[model samples]
Target: MQTNNTPQNIAIIGAGASALFVSIILAKKGFHVTLFEKNPKAGKKLLATGNGKCNITNKNLSLNYFFSSNPSFIKYSIENFGYKEFLTLCEEIGLNLVTNENGKTYPASLQASSVVDVLYNEALFLGAKFSFDSKVENIDFKEKAHIISGDKTYKFDKVILATGSIAMEKLGGCSSGYELAEKFGHNIIKPSPSLVQLTSNDKEIHTLSGVKSEANVTLLVDNKPQKTLFGDLLFTNYGVSGNTILDLSREANMAILNFQKVDIVVDIFPTLDKNKLLALLEKKKKILSGKDKNSLLLSLINGKLIPFIYKKAKIDSKKYFIDNLDKKDLQALTYTLKSIKIPIDGSKGFDSAEVVAGGVNVDEVDNKTMESKKQKGLYFCGEVLDVDGACGGYNLHWAWASAFSLASNMK
Candidate 1:
């Protein structure tokens, strides 16, 4: 704590969640807070989160939901500023929050702008200043923090790098934060696209585009099963997407980066086992005898998938009638339905990614204070650090929790 009468000036780069949050906290503590944003307005990315509803945080505040090269580094911040604390903060800020059965908490208005508005308003009301269209190109750290934005140079007592990550550049994501960290001797873990749509080279699977089914998706890396998730599985012209795919994308994208073979085995009928599915098909065959084999699966599955399934089973739908199908044919079709392998060639890249997997390595930062061990008065928060969370509001929670921890210790 400073005993001097002089007020400490703090400069925060980026007007995203963490920056806005820290600004409010520091400003309320009597520090001069200035936020430098490249965009014309704050929270451009916040407007796009949760499909514009803005998933504020998750009720289930589990460390398992977050990932980092230095995983343990996030434990202190998350555990200290859990969901309850975040909710209390929301209440204090006059934001009405609602949580669903799945634990995803959102504003009652279901508008992301509501969140941005409240945070920005509170920060401004507390005397925090905003420098819109002022992108900090670089920072020179010495006796004081010097920020370079275009032709202007501004100095401050402390600087916080909250520039976020380069996940969605269209929404103002950039490498400035990481570049600044690297200059201060902080290591950067290579970043990869996370929670993004995957791309497949299987042109045959592409034909089934626009088809969605509730099923189990198993991610196979190097011919071995790595992880499995159950939810909506959408077949796109490029590859696959949906809730399950986005959840599994981080591991898949990381594997692809490591030059490993990545594949997703989609079970169209997760509720039924192979044997039960085969029995069901046999029963359908008997009832639909003499009708085209295609008709056997008419009401059972999507019409577009009948041909695809038949092709995968190596049975000609045009030639085989229900009566012409034998027990072996039914078993083959059952197997095909149980395991529809789609090879993942790549992802939609950073532009389409919801978040990035890696960032500035956290090993050099004080997890409790979010201050750089290499540089004094320099702090990091939010996605700019190598920490990223799984889908379903975990990332946003991290942004809030990290900023909370940083602000609490700033004095």
Candidate 2:
């Protein structure tokens, strides 16, 4: 695998977001690039993203938005092929975009299939060929050629290991990406499930199953608050879910593994502060004196959560007004509603996770080129690497940013 000057028939393992980028950019450079996908289709996982709407990239590209083993590794690629550049590329491929209020970019059509189709079209137009049902068994580098996918060996002057990670097993993800990296003598930084819903050990959450509310979740690691998030929280038989809970799930996973107390503080009535909430409840009691608990509570919170909230607050359903409530009762109800706590015991794992965290350590790869420090012709990109970003379009941004360098660096 010498860095010899030769026209590489670059072989990209996996037909995911990064693989498509590799194919398009390398093929455009007039290099022969073959994409191998184990699934019956390319972008199977991509098509499943954003609830099939496909959040392509975040409109903003800032360093604080992502996490990685090598914290600085993403700076170069992100700066070069940033969010704006990615949108421009999408536009070039006939996929115009719309940025949401929070800066998450989606296709104008709002269908993930539209984005996948355009990416597929771009790769095909660039002369890259895809081989489906082509599962890779092993990869070895010899004189600028990669022998991969078992006996069906591939010869490439440069090889991009954009095989992705083990997240969606039913969709063919099983650490093939990590296996490919290890075969090339690279170190993987322990893979685990992330961006998934957490199951709580507390029995209370189960009783309130099917109840969803706009709340905030704060993650505790080693009995310390690690991160906080606010959004829609869904209660389930096993545990808690939804946008807010998912953001803080990784911390819950880590803390739960260590047998630490992992809890989510849900601010059910985020719009009303503690004092204001109490005042509002007192005022409403006088206005709706004869109404039942469900009726009065429904006007304030979702009717679905009334029973559970009443149970947690130790409030009698027979009584409707705060006029009969003592100070202790008022404070308890406010605390339970404004800061309901759920214990984290387990997670939905890869199946429900949007993306997997903790992959090939960034220390072992070149940031600018994504070339493995241990292997001459090998490269890593996408979720298979150690980079994990926050919700929104940050994950897709990482994939595109990492692969953009790989595609450009290929000779």
Inter-residue clash pairs, candidate 1 = none
lDDT of 1 by residue, 84-136 (tens): 99989889889999999999999999999999999999999999999999999
The sequence of per-residue lDDT tens digits that candidate 2 reaches over residues 247-329 is 78766776666678777778888888999998877676677666654554676787767777778888866665545665676
TM-score of each: 0.98, 0.93
The residue-level lDDT of candidate 1 at 206 comes to 93
Whole-model lDDT values for every prediction: 0.93, 0.79
Kindly report which residue pairs in candidate 2 clash with one another: 1-143
Each model's backbone clash number: 0, 1
